[model samples]
Target: MEGYKKIIKKLLFFNEPKKMERFVLKETSSKENRTEDSAENNAEKDKQYRARRRKEPGGIRKIDRGTDESSKKEKEIQKEDENKRKDSEVSVYLSHNLTSMKRLYNIPMNGDVVIREFDIILKDRAVGAFIIFFDGMTDRKVINNNILQPLMMLSSLEIKKAEEDIAEYIKKQILPHNQMKEFTSYRKIMDEVNFGGCAIFVDGIAKAFTGDVKGWEHRGVERPNTELVIRGPQEGFTETIRTNTALIRKRLKDEDLICQNFEIGERSNTPCSMMYIKDIANESLVEEVAKRLKSLKVDYLSDSGELEQFIEDSSFLPAPQIIATERPDRVATALTEGRVAVIMHGSPFVLIMPITAEDMVKSPEDNYVRFPYGNLFRLIRYFGIALSLLLPGLYIAITNYHQEMIPTDLLFSIEAAREMVPFPSVIEILIMEIAFELIREAGIRIPGPIGPTLGIIGALILGQAAVAANIVSPVLIIIVAVTGIGSFAAPNFSLAFSFRILRFAFIIIGAMAGFLGITTGLFIYGMWLVSAKSFGVPFLVPFGPKTANAFTDSILRAPIWKQERRPDYLNPKDDRRQAPISRGWMDNGSKGEDEDEQ
Candidate 1:
């Protein structure tokens, strides 16, 4: 071993022969020391690592506790904020102090809020009274002539005798306004003030009087932008809910026509009017609509569109269950047919409920036009609906899977047009369809008189450019144009939108399995429609459940005299719309002659 050590030392250190023995001895000692030191260092490191691992869980626990505390503090702050808001909404009570009433209005801070203070003389006593209104919301002329003029100047002479109750005397004989109400809640009074009305507060009275002086600038009852008919009522619903309800009421003039008022939205407090002929409409249907509207807990309801989305039966379905129309005549007609109309404040569109697929397709003109012409137009619309939904999918299916379905010359032509195109038929169609949709959306959003013109020009230019560039085949352009025209032919805009969405879906399905995929998709769509319900009425009504006297009105428009009964599907209280012998004057005098002969 010593000899081997000497050889290693000579090779590694290259020491002199005399010191080789000493070097070997020193190297052996150093190796033993290194082994001992390495063992000790490793043991120390293991001990330190174990100590850190043991403390890690505790540190994590402390962090979690800190997070929990922070979350708790945040929740507490939110709770306090909510409580403060509720406290601020405390009810208003009439105090003998006029300064307190002014404070209640948050005067000096709110610039638009106006408070006019005056004295009312009753014999020898003068009582302090004030009126509060928003600047732009209320009509200053009406408030001056009707409310303030009588209370401030005319009341002194009118109440020559001593008045024990000032509130009753002013309310009964002083205020000449037609629409005035006494309200006790501060929340309610503020709401009235916000919505174009003035509130009168008396120093000695516990209640405040609210008058309807809503004369803010608004659009007049104009012709409907959508749902235009050739021979029907020209007037449409305005943004004002009262005016809309009045429009419907004017048409019906029935005592049983009920228009119940509801306030929806937490912040908005938008007025919603539910109208129905009490004797004709089903009770359950009306109650269902009310229940849905009441149960909504939203902070703001901007329009009928939002309300419809929230209360609709199914959000996943593409088809709109509620029929939204701006026409007051349509609302009246639906009310007569045992349907409920929900008119939202600040939106011209009125929602007609318990609608069927057939109802969406029918235009108001169908009723006004002669039966033969109406039936012809209705049939054409049906064809348009089919073309819009199925045409593109059929094109994709036939070109991809069943080319034999097309005529020989047409197939050759399609092949020639597509030869220059780089993409497949499916891709080409998708490109064109997407381009068309973009054009449609741009047309709607573009401002001014150029909007409609831009849409037409844009579509024409895009179609021509696409074909010229060979990005899309010429045949596809014609197919897309026809599909777009068909979409326009749909009577209801919502229904048209539904068809547009389904067109894309069918296109995708057709590309996958051709004819088989289209068939499957159609079956599923039909099943969904049949299963869906709009306010308890089946979406595919008069067809799925098969109601009598309803089928004639669905696809075909029967003569007005023959359609003597209301739709059986609605379960209207009154089934007969007219007498069986409605056209008795035109009939032969068989019964009258027999009676005369006897």
Candidate 2:
């Protein structure tokens, strides 16, 4: 009835009509008036402020007492807050600890955090206890058989330490987990729980028990996707950081090998493992790496790639100062050389630091193969890098400006090929380079076997189409193709990327002033790279500074037995890696003595 009356009244004459805003298109005089008034007031205030500043001693106004008091009070409040938070130990009260767990983890909302409450049969009576873990992260069988079953059936386990500390009792006898620890700090227990471990809290105990039962789903050890080698171990580093550390340990069983765990990132609290031979690696270098990592103010570190950027020497440098490899053998090689490897949680790629430019061209496969084969491959890889970086520039320069450099027959053939092309040499090369890069990137982005297939087929079809259209010369297509293949041959992915990016710059300079411009760019680029450092080691170590045994293990691989000493630049504690004349049969008893005498 009220709705009908309202509708009828609206149809007749609405009482709210006067309240409705009626549009009156008039000049906004009030806004103009207000602007004038505000301008005058602001001018007065500015004049007064300037006069006050001039009157003040040394143009400095006295601090406000009220603000000072407020600041002091704020400091006191923060100090009090700190004092309150300093007691981060696990509480003896079960309800308080349970409430804290709920508040911290947002219980009832977070479905992944599983909290199971049960009773443990003590010597005299049953004790209230609970275990907290992520559902998918923990191994159910381990928890059921090892943890819950043992604690619930504690009477059969024969607990003789009734008078002992409950936390120690639980750690020593109650829990049969291989890796168990009693953590008094609740934050540490939560951290362990976050990384796929279960935390056990007893009714009266002030410490929590952490079990290492991480069983998260991850890819198994397989051939490295990027750093694949034909003659070396097929196993690659997985997303699991501990697995990576174990892989390194499996390769190297030296007693001095240390894998120290560090928690980085304020919010993410990522576990980073720094592995090195304590006796071989320079103390200062390890300290420097640790300092940089600890001082990082980032809230989250997702991968080693992101971390490499943060801790690296310079961001503007072209070549990568650090080596990021997925092969455990490579990491082990770096560690054996007195370098440090940082393995970030959830990332397969491990970062090996204090690398040199020569290190960029070397590969793990080199160590596995014979010296001759290694030397041959290293030479070819270097040549390929040079080709990838300089081929396009050289082509542009020779065709555009240095025509006489080419043999007469080749020059004539090149002229014949470009005669049908409407674009200049620069444009022709640029078209082919961009087209090749597009094809390569498309191949990578596309899935599985189809990717490689598309790259091959697409390049052939596109090159043929472009040549038919006379958009690019046939010679240029061959040049671009060769350049791409050279790039793919680079051992380090990061170094290859560095060359790819600089290729464009070389192209531009080569086009502008021919060989002179290219040479100048090279000089500047060399200086830029030479000035860069990787954790105090020069980018061109052993090459620029002429260190000992530089050539033996650098660009050209000497026989494994010949690399007797470590690289001089690292300043490692143990200078001699191996005895001279390392091959026992080759020693001949007197050969090494004779060489030593000489």
Deviation from native of the Cα of residue 373 in model 1, angstroms = 0.7
Q: What is the TM-score of each candidate against the true structure?
A: 0.84, 0.84
Q: Write the per-residue lDDT of candidate 1 for residues 87-110, one digit (tens) a residue.
A: 342223334334544555556987
Which stretches of model 2 miss by more than 4 angstroms? 1-87, 156-165, 588-598
Give candidate 1 misplaced runs (Cα > 4 Å): 1-105, 157-164, 587-598
Worst 10 residues of 2 by lDDT: 55-64
Residue-level lDDT tens digits of model 2 in 1-598: 9999989988999565467688996533243443344778757755554443322222223322331232333345444544333336777878767876775677999999999999877656777888999999989999999998988886334444642466666777778889988787767888899889998888888778899988889999989989888898999999898889999999999999998889998779999999899999999999999999889998998899999999999998989999999999989988988999999989999999999898888888998999999889988898899999999999999888999999999999989988888888888788788888898899999997999999989999999999899888888888998899899889999989999999999999999999999999999998887888889988887877778766788767778888898888999999788887677876676787898899
lDDT of 1: 0.84
In model 1, pairs of residues that clash are none
Q: Candidate 2, after superposition: displacement of residue 264 in Å?
A: 1.2
> Model 1, 325: alpha-carbon shift in Å?
0.2
